[model samples]
Structures are given as C-alpha cells and as structure tokens.
Target: MKKSLVAALAVFSLVNAEQISIGGTSFERVDALKAYEVGCASNDADACFEAGWIHYQRQNLNKAIELYTRACNANNYKACTNLGALYFSGEGVKVDIKKAKELFSKACELGDGDGCNNTAFLYEQKKDIKTALKLYKKACDLGHQIACGAYKELSK
Candidate 1:
C-alpha cells in the first residue's frame, strides 16, 4: 500500500512539473487544473483563485465561478472581488446586482481596496452618493489610487 501511494505521488509530481522546451522546441503545458485542485484540497486559497483565473481565461465561466466562490469563502478578498465582478456583469450566470454588492461589501470589509471601489461604483449607479462617497473614501484609505481620485472628485 505504501509503495502504491509513493508511486501515485511520484506520478502526480511528474504530471505537475513545468513543461520544458529545448533548442526552440516546446512541450505541452502541465495540467494546471489538477495541480490547483490538489492545492485547493489542502486549503490553499491562492491556489483556488489561480485555478479560477485559469478557468476564466479559458472561458469556462461556470467552473471559474465555482472555484472563485470556494476561494472567497476561504477569505480570499481578491477571489471575492472577481466573483462579484462576474455577478455584476451577468457573466456565466444571471444578473444579480444585489449578490454582487454583497460580495463586494464582504471583500471590502476584508480589506480589498478594489472591492471597496467596486462597491462604491455600484452605490453611485444606484444614486446613493452618500454611500458611494463613504466607500470611495474607504478604498482611498486602503491605498487605491483610483479611489483616491474619485474621493477627491466627489469631495470637491
């Protein structure tokens, strides 16, 4: 049993190795999804986010959303922001501005400047200038340059 486990791990490691190119030749890329899945299974939120990004890049929106949600639940604010953007844009799922706002708020509370900025934009679109200003200010305080500019503009 131990030998079988060792063999399996060795095979897995080989599969996850970076592809090599020699003398102007190229090799097929490693299976990033499998590697990420292993990482995510170990509770690595960043790996889950990376997997989601790969899926997004491949236009596999549903899979991206699933992975992003998992990372977000693990307190990965960037993943929350990404998932919120998908909800806001109705990409791969029905439009859910309310859900997007909730996710953005969660991410902002977790100290994601971009999430705060996004939430502020949503509030601005809803004609809630007061909330927008507050959120923009929060984002600015978090060192978001664009949010600082918006805060300055709104304060003027």
Candidate 2:
C-alpha cells in the first residue's frame, strides 16, 4: 500500500509539473505557450494559430489578432476563420463585413465547418436564403452540430 501511494504521488507530480504557477496563480500547461511561440517563430502556421488561441482565451485580443493574421497568411484555414470572427464582431479591429466574408469563404473552401456556418450566417443576414441553406448544409455535412440544427430549421 505504501509503495502504491508513493507511485501515485510521483505520477501526480509528473503530471502537475507541466503546469505553471505565476504570482500565486496556477495555469494549465503554460509551457505549451512557449513551445507554440518557438514553433511560430519558425514559421509554423499551426503553432501560430494555437498561440493566437491562447491569447484569445486570455482576452488579449490584439495579440490574438496579430498571431491569427500570421497563421492566416500562411493559409491556415482555422486561423482565417478565427481572425474573420474577430473582424466580424469588431473585437480587436474595425468591423469589416466584406473582409470577414472573404476570409470565411477562403476557410470554407479549405473545408472548415465553422467557416461554412459563418458564411451561411452572413448570407442569411443578407436575406440570401438559397446560399445560406446551401452553406449550412455543407457545414452540417462536415459535422458542425450548430450548423446541423440551423440546416434543419432552415430546411423546414
């Protein structure tokens, strides 16, 4: 029993070691940010996207936009979708529906389900029911749960 307790404690410590404590605040796997930063510095688009996601979660919208833009420029579809959302909602930049639409279209072309759904939403707002239904169907087929619900409602 003592041996089992010691082994369990060791495993717990190993797992917890990956987390970071800053000024009495503990954060989950903060070291992942460093790894992402290094990968982004090396021009890895996925890493840039991940770093942007972390900044977004922390409510650092400016930094998130910056990193997401970098990843989007590298043709990261998910990054483009996220950046487009920020622009669409005027989170860190001016609201530019045209730019957001363009980015959403690009991401949809790259097979991103959220992009398809967002593009459908824009079309729905524009009263283009046909295009909205088509895009929503596409998103639904790509396994977007929200899109599936929207598609069902719109189809009905």
> Which 10 consecutive positions of candidate 2 have the poorest summed lDDT?
2-11
Question: Candidates' lDDT values, in order?
Answer: 0.82, 0.82
**Per-residue accuracy of model 2 over 42-142 as CA lDDT, tens digit each:** 78788789778888988999889999999999889999999999889999899999999999988998899999999999999999999999999999999
Question: TM-score of model 2 relative to the true fold?
Answer: 0.79
What lDDT would candidate 1 get against the real structure? 0.82
Instruction: Show the colliding residue pairs in model 1.
Output: none
Q: Quote the positional error of residue 133 for candidate 2 in Å.
A: 1.2
Candidate 2's displacement at residue 120, Å, is 0.3
Error of 2 at 35 (Å): 1.1
- lDDT by residue for model 1 over 67-110, one digit each (tens)? 99999999999999999999999999899999999999999999
